[model samples]
Target: GFADGTLRLGHLEVKASVLTHDAVPDGLTKLDNGDSTDGQAVYADTAGGQVRKVAVEAVLGSPQQIAPAGTAVVAADYRLGGTEERPEKSFVTVDATGIGRLSRTESRTNMMTGEVTETLTSSVLPGLPTGVKVTTVIMNTAADMVLVADNTGTLYRYDTHNFNAPVLAETLKPLPEGVTLTGIRFLIGEQSIVLTGSDGSVDVYFRLPRDNAKSSDGYTLIRAHQLEKHRGAVVAIDASQRGKMFVTADDTGEVWLRHSTSEQTLLKLKPADINGHYQAVALSPRENEIFAVTDGGQVYNWDIEADHPETTLKTIFGKVWYEGYPEPTYTWQSSSGTDAFEPKLSLVPLIFGTIKATVYSLLFAIPIALGAAIYTSEFVHPSVRAVVKPVMEMMASLPSVVLGFIAALILAPVVETWIAAVIISIAVVPTAWLISAFLWQLLPGPVALRYGGWPKFALMFAVLFLAANLSIAISPLFERLFFAGNFKAWANGSVGSSLAFTTLLILPAVVGILYFVGERVLPSQIYEIMRSPNRTIAGVADFVRWIITLMVGGIISWVLAGLLIGVGLDPRGGIVDTFVQRNTMIVGFAMGFAVIPIIYTIAEDALNSVPEHLRGASLGCGATQWQTAIRVILPTAMSGVFAAIMVGMGRAVGETMIVVMAAGNTPVMDWNIFNGLRALSANIAVELPEAVKGGTLYRMLFLAALSLFAITFIVNTLAEIVRQKFRKRAAQL
Candidate 1:
């Protein structure tokens, strides 16, 4: 359609001229009638600055003026209100001053005379600035929202839900200095806008809620992504009806096919390939072909092959600067309710989550599983071993989903309540065990020999049980002393509390180092005295030395923590940050419970398989039963123990239901034991059912599965190699 009211149909190859309307004195500024078959079209006349409706036929009907004269209509849009067969029509006109009028037409029929009459109603849309030269006025299909662009590069967003009292939602200046906004159009979903600049820059802008905003309707327009720049001014832009893909053509005769979400330039066609410089371009209804027409009456069509343009190696694996994010980050939000939502498909977080879950699970599982294996195989009586081994093996049959259910519904809350006690137990239980062992050595030789083996194990268990209960009883005092009565608040608060938390966390390491250094630095006379034949004297000396070591280690840790804080190294981020209830610690505990039975069973079987003669020989040489087991049996079974831990690791890596239900399923890249995580397996289990076949999310899920497989393959291969080395070393032993 031209400004002279000449309507044409068909392409350049075969064109047909439609009815030409009566000439206007100042030509038509805009023409719109929607998809109407009634031959009625509303157009804006510049001469009288009036919006007039005219019937198109062999001879055009008399112009029925809608708006009053002298009000210049700069732009107008029409939309269908009812069914296509009997459409109620509405149109809005924006004058040069940016004020708009919405007019709706309703038809009524006289039943007796069979005469049809039309009624027109008008309402003022108020919000836009007055006296500004309006260049474009666009209304969404619902007619409740409008965008007005004036000559100044500013875009006005209006909420016209109440047409007579429209609200101005936001205004945006998306262009930079010296770069004029050439045109703007809504993408397929109308939630995003494609803004083109005179400098050939194309950018996407969308509405996002302001962070911590006070108002419910507080949203700001943000420039999300910038596509490939054109060589010259972009003349035409059109978006596909089905997807986020769009086509842009520049005056330099270059056409580029781009996707909004992935920010990918799928294809580019030069002027030589298209044979014309198109001034206007459009995507076909099916989005399979692009049709473009040049001002010189030349038309060109190109087929587009852009399936899965949103997925690439870089987009899937690397950090992406997504629509509303301030910086590039790894994210994995795959699907949303709206068509305009951008898919964040990065797999880095999932992978990190898998590793974190495995490592934490192993940390909790290995010591307990191996300790139980050693005790059952060597220290415990055969009857106790017989009962314990079967019970441990039976634990492996418990379903992971059942464990996850218990963890999420019961254990998580309990652990959160007793978290301070749990932390205190880490230090208290081991120290209590050492004190109990020293006390046992102090007992008379006759009584010690009489209450050995099962009695000894029972005694140690009682000591640990008491230690655990004591830790729980003192939990409040411990929190008050170190954490200011609130562990979470203290841990996440100032540097002083962070330093205190860091010191406690590193206390065990400090103690271990001090023990090693003390063994070398302490007088030989002291060790000899601790090993004296007098049981009471040796035990008392050993207890005093252990107490002194603990106190020194605590003092050193406090100093080290202060130095770390002084250098801006607070222990409140990365792996350890703000605490949550259903977090990595709870998941680790649940997953560790699931992994322990596997590791313990395999390791116990391997320890039992070791030849009894080796143990007998070591004991025959006057070494203790503990010495025989630690020096001979453990080394010979090291290969199997290593393999058991590796197998348990594989189990943890592939765990889905447990992490899904208990881990909170957040795809965040933090190692904080108190924070939640989402693993690759859990992600696949959660999202696969909703993913469309052959879609980007479905393919990415498959890729996630492949990555899991590769991780297990590499881990098992390395385990086997290391196991072989251990086996050869055991052969020499």
Candidate 2:
């Protein structure tokens, strides 16, 4: 029996003469007594194209007549004619009393005469009840057909050419449920019929001449062997046209391909190996391809009789486009342009907006942060450092939304009017510092030492006081000096004539000239530091003071540049405009303020960690405390300070709330400080929740996340590298 779908029988030692040219079995009869016996059958033509089954006791004797009457004898009736004298022509049909018949036309001729003797029944078929179909059928070497009945247990057979004639075929008992036939195979040289089904169903029939069961109305079906191979539902069945091989597939995607060998011969071939369970299977009608699809929507194809399945020729994504489908074919109107509405995830604008915001924020942030680090770490008094560091660090913890609101609602307005006031602050602070230093030098040396550096501090406070008071004090004075008692009125008179260009525009040119002249000659303190090498108390004070100056100046310049870029250099009259609209300094202010605590904590830690021995050693070498801090302690703690700054940078870059709330979200590419800008963290947080899950927007958000993570990673990595380098440098020293 075949593993799942087929069975085969080999040569059965039947008489050679029984293998005749008559491909169809002529007739069958059942002997009485119901036990099997045998009789003669012939392959012959009948009259006028009708086939005839002539019963011949010429060889095998009828068991019914010889033994008890109940004994059954199988026989076949093959004659020279059926209805008319057409020797070479015949018609055949299977006559099962309880089952339906199968008829076909065939041809026959008298070997002695060259003429057509009869027209035989042609395509012979099996007999079965209506609705009880021939679940399996097979044609033998003699062109005889065998069929398994679906209802009444029966195996019916017929020879070609016995059409519309009386021919009793052997009948077998019905099969049990869950035993649907799969294939019917005939061994050409064996004169046998082999039946196979889905699982554990196999039967074989072998007889010399004709069995008496062929003459009976009912015959017992002998189960030869049962096959128990496949574990699932049989999905497909196929046979080689030559009957040499057959195959079957199961719902589990396993296949059994085998060649047929008679009972004693070996007949087996490997089947195709396609992975996964299959729903439907089809062999390509044009090629050696066998295709199947699984329940999970995957399709596969394999070469016929091949060992393994090949690469997946197609996937679902490719399948969609292969049929000419477009990506992004569907779109919805996402917004109605209100506060409730948000922008779409068009790659261009979101990316631009993100870069613009981050650039502005960083442009605003870096100078102030670095400058503050240098000052607090280098110059500020211990008492001042304590207060300033905590305040700044605490500010870092402030919610960015509040800052954003202030920038949008409060700062933007102040910067606008006092744009000039803010710009002037940049020059005012330094000039004030110079004046303060001049005042400190004028103080008596003994008074300066008794104050223990309070003189320098007092000088700075007075300078700041004077500069700010002076700006307020002289603003009206300058307005009158420049605009003839009514700056706005005068400028409006000149610009209102054309509403185009005015002295307000020309002011930038004047400022540009002043700035070019200023860079050529830096502040006096920088000169003082460059000139002094005494490492004296005054030198340390000068350096710290100048460092603080640079920090404040850097912050102001950064903020001013931002404002000029964000809006313009024009000084509006509104106090709100003076703060926010005056320059891009707002971003610098926001970011710098945001990171101050982090940098302060980190820098102080680094400074505190510096070895006390180094400072003591410097002092023993006649260096003053300030000189020790500047020449020895500062350099020794430099690594820690640099680390603090780097970590603070990472903090600034990753600060989401501050940037999101503070950045304007405008997709502009300007470097202006007065304008608001976006940052990556802020953009991602703002857009992520709104993005559809698993869509382009969602993936893009993921990419942004990856980028942010990467930036932090790189910054931390660099910080570590710098820290290690510093450690190595210190160790060498």
Candidate 3:
């Protein structure tokens, strides 16, 4: 107990009679004076409106002389700043009575003599009622702002950067109608406040930015979470020195352990023999023990065993409103430079990223692998197939780390410069192949048969090469005409550019559907005439049909895109926003290169294993090789082809090194081809080494692994079920 400038702890007593000016100290705070060997304590002399400090030493054994640290003139409660290293050199004090006023004081101590000198500044804090007295003052770790509470249960926020001209930022009434405010303290990092009320309420408030027009400072206080209520008025509260845990004591003699971020009541303890109301409570420095003092001068202590109080199911899987954020969001920041940092471990973004990476890679790999397998199995000569199959199979042996390095260092920069050309080639290459095939069919019968073996394949390759180069040469002109000469800027958020880009992305599908419908809608007489034996007439008819289908499809796509944009449903704002250099496009291309060989090899083997008798029967029935392969062989081999694709998808889902190096490793949930992602595999690879064993991060990484395993197991199980159905259907043949 403290009285007459004397403080007693167990069997020890400290006297500072002269420094207190014979006034009894109402509040006391111990400070780390930056020396492990010496102790310093500050006392608030509210009656005299002064703060006093004394150096404590055990050897001296007698009452030590106390010195004046600073003065507040009408001091109520004083708290020092939150800098851990430089401890307690600056503090703020609130007025005990009168219009709301605060004192900001800084002290400098002599190293040798321990003499202290102070500089004091005072300011009137606005937003409080006219005649209310200030009761408690608390400052954040940054020390640029302070929260002052008045006797009327009103909280006022003051900007203390300019000490003489403090600005009142916000006014809040957070307590209930009949409840009085007893105490408030900042949790670790000072981004959250724990307030105790006279009606046994414990609530937490987070600093949020204001959305009102009257406030220009852009900040307000909000009640975010409330813990379990106490049985009586909560008289004393104290927070942990290291984490989000705190201890509170009520008049009913019950003490509760709680966490701020998780909003969990960890434990409750009631002293067995205590019968009086507790006046003060404290958490030990390491947070392993709790100490409470009753008004009858009795002290009770309890040992605690709480760990990882900040982690919970809601915190790991659901959206959380973290400190210093505007609203609740999915975030994955796991570590920081400061010890007071909060750990955010949401795994939603990583799972989304894993699925996204798999889908994009399969979109790039499946068509090319299957197309190559069909051509090799049905049309190529035995000698050429021997060479091509071996070479394609050898591609699977390349190292993924080497591919990631090439993609990140070489492909990303080149693609960013020619992305417009790359997109144009998607249409150009397929159209060039179609036109070349039509022209080749117009050749005389003997010449066509003579060159159809290896020469045909070589010519097709040359045409593809020429088409790619043509797109690259025309890229600058195309961008200038369609995207205002700056595709990146246009893609970011220009009006009509997003619609135009969307139209182009969906153009191929639209054109294919139109072609299919055109064939069905054509008159039978004209179709037979166009399919006549004359090569020149047939080729010209088909070319004209293709051109008409393309034009009509483009018009339909433009109208559809415009209608979507009119409804505020443009793709630009959601999954397809902002262009990033090293993004999903680059990672997909690199991982597809790693996945293609497995699919191609398996699919080609399946196609080659089809029965020779089926081919003979189709030919004997006057069916062409192309018709036989498409209608007969492909249906029989569908089950094997699908299994191969599923295997490739599994490879893409578990890929680590390639995505880690080339994907920019951002855990964002966007589906834009130009945005970066961080997959579960990559996240585990990158963060596991730094995670401490038996820590929250270490366990969370294991959970990520479990999620990945579940995804693969479920997909494979479904795939096997579908494969069996397909195989049963094929058996009837």
**Cα lDDT tens digits for candidate 1, 1-733:** 1222221122223222333235323333332543222223434333454333444335332233444555556677666576643445566677644666766666666779967676667777666666767766777777776777777778777766775566777776778766766778888767778889878999988666777533225776778778889989888989988778899999888888998877899988765655556778998877789888898877888887777877878788887766667557899898788766777899999999999999998999999999999989987778778888999999999999999999999999988899889988987998898888888888998898777767887888899889999999999999888788888886677433666777887888999999889989999999889878888898899889989988999999999999988998876775567888889988899999999999999999999999888888998996767778888899999999999999999999999989999999999998788899999999999999999998878889999999999999999999999999999998886
Residue 465, model 1: Cα distance from true site in angstroms: 3.4
Estimated TM-score for each candidate? 0.76, 0.41, 0.86
Candidate 3's residue-wise lDDT over 520-567, tens digit each? 898887676667688778777777777888899999999887888888
Top lDDT model: 1
Q: After superposition, how far is residue 126 of candidate 1 from its true place, in Å?
A: 14
- Model 2 stretches astray by more than 4 angstroms: 1-388, 453-462, 472-584, 616-631
**lDDT (0 to 1) per candidate:** 0.80, 0.48, 0.80
Candidate 2 lDDT by residue in tens digits, 105-215: 334555688555322233323344544443444433333333444433345554333344434355554355656555455432433345555553444444323244444
Q: C-alpha displacement of 427 in model 3, angstroms?
A: 2.4
Candidate 3 whole-model C-alpha lDDT, 0 to 1 = 0.80
The C-alpha RMSD of each candidate to the native structure, in angstroms, is 9.4, 29.1, 8.1
